[model samples]
Target: MKILHRQRHDQSSSMIFRKDYTLLIIYLSLSLVSGEFMTAGVVAVGSAISAGLLAGFNVINCMINECCTDRWVSTNYTDLKLTLDAKLYGQHLVIEPVVKHLKAHGKDNPSKALALSFHGWTGTGKNYVSRIVAEKMFAKGMKSKFVHLISATKEFPHKEMVPFYKDKLRDFIEARVKECPRSFFIFDEMDKMPPGIIDTLKPYLDFYENLGGVDYRKATFFFLSNTAGNDIAERTITTWTNNLDRETIKLKEMEEVIRLPALNNKSGLWHSELILKNLITAYVPFLPLERRHVKQCIKDGLVHKGYYKSEDEISDAKVQEIADELQYYPEGVLIFSTTGCKRIHEKIDLIMEEI
Candidate 1:
């Protein structure tokens, strides 16, 4: 009798395990069909009336991790703003419009792919801002399969290869958008791109519901170039000499300044139809970093490198010591860092070695 009772208990446990496993499979099926957790919840709660609460929780967890929910492509404007404020030094003009445009794009269905052209001297936070934007929008950040960063000089080197590059570029864009509607493409060193190749993106950037059945309007493209760096720098220098606050410099003042030159220059945007059609949404200007801002960068670098706990912990003398190591421009007034925070980490590494 004891042996028979033990066998019955084991059978009962096996039955319970099978029932729970079956319920989980059903929940996943419902989720996949409806693309919603609420639908799965209804089915699981109603069908698995006797299943343990642990099983229900497991179902929800799987849906969140495996499904294309808010976890994959949700935007957090607050985090973007806070990160820009904390990590990016100076460039007060950048924070507001960037957040505003991204917020607007996040909330509404844009008619065209949002295109932003970043113009500035090197290391003035253009690429830095792009990375931050990607991180805030996608769960996987820069490593996200949906985000594509391509360099013109590296990716399309020869002028004779323009035709080949154009076809490949178009095909890649189409494929990426088809796979993920909210894809991001960053074209770095836009100035180095062979002139006609960039115009290939014109169709994707224009106002269209879909190109070849793939909706490109939900995508975002960023063009990073030094095309208008000299013009932007001269404007900033004029503003400083006149004793006007850099914050007072408006986007309107810079847009026209950059627009004419970007179109006329021998770089990628030169005579490109994207410019002629006015497909680009905004021209973001990054100002050259002043001595004070470079000092801040140095201090931040020290904290980031783990040499100090915080910016406040680093002494002014030490910060100044590193700042002095970098060459500044214009000779007489020494207004801006010649490299604009580029190669800062290398400088920090060298300084630490000396110590």
Candidate 2:
């Protein structure tokens, strides 16, 4: 039985070798007939073919799983702009800076790793924007191996584990950056993270070209927090009360309002070196969603779930019915959606079930 098994394995190996040899012959013949082998020389022709094959294999591998090849790392700035414009509602303040920063980062080698701090009320598109950015930057989106998403509450649940968590976090970041220089790290629930734990990221987020031989300058970091949600809401409400266009609210205005609160708040970034040293690239505030914006979200939800073919197919009455289901805030005015567009899909699912 052993002899017969060996004979079959040898036959299979011979078949594969013959197949590969035949393919090589056919490739060389095609190259010669096309005059490529004559002009480029035999060695150059062979190298070109080898590189093409390698690229093809890499493309296939990236489709099957996450990879660090150009296939996965390529960024689509146009698509990013279109997506944010369409899906993100009520945050005119978010669109320009996010796109411009990402475009600059994608186009040139940065002096330091790109770090963005997102602050806003829950469901105001903080997490949604993060996911969108990941999708636009990576072919596999958030599932890409280079994208590291760490939830503060889940990763560092206990204050006693801060020391151990710090070490583990440092080692993890170093390893990921070594594997892929363009690594993306996102920290969610930054408000719940224990103090001193996030300070460990100071080195990676700094202006240093390398830390211990690993180049972290090409990496990107995002810190999502609800620390300044109330402040952001109040500012937006004040703007609306003054009859000022929300779009006219500048980044500087929002930054001035939230910067102090963020530094003082008991979040991961609270008094952290990342804030004190000015390592954060931008403090993006996601403005609260108004009733009309919530209606847009409902229309989008209907279209996304296949309940409607297009936004036009959904009536204002239907959209308002779903929008009214969500709780609004600011007492008499009830100006902003308390939850923004968060869980809007679930709300749609519930309403559909009733039908």
Top TM-score prediction, candidate number: 2
What lDDT does candidate 1 reach at residue 72? 78
Which regions of candidate 1 deviate over 4 angstroms? Answer: 1-68
CA RMSD of each candidate after superposition? 11.5, 9.0
Q: How many pairs of residues collide in model 1?
A: 0
- For candidate 2, list the clashing residue pairs, or say none: none
**lDDT (C-alpha) at residue 46 in model 2:** 69
Whole-model lDDT values for every prediction: 0.81, 0.82
| Tens digit of per-residue lDDT, candidate 2, span 123-157 | 89988999999998888778777887888877888
How well does model 2 score by local distance difference test?
0.82
Q: Model 1 over residues 1-355: C-alpha lDDT tens digits?
A: 0100111113465456656777776666565456464576666664565355456655565344422346678755888899999889978878888888888877557788889999988989889999999999888778776778888877888898788888888788887788788888889998888899889999999998887788888888999999899999999989989999888889989998888888999889999998899999999999999988988888888888999997777888887788888988787989788788887888888887654
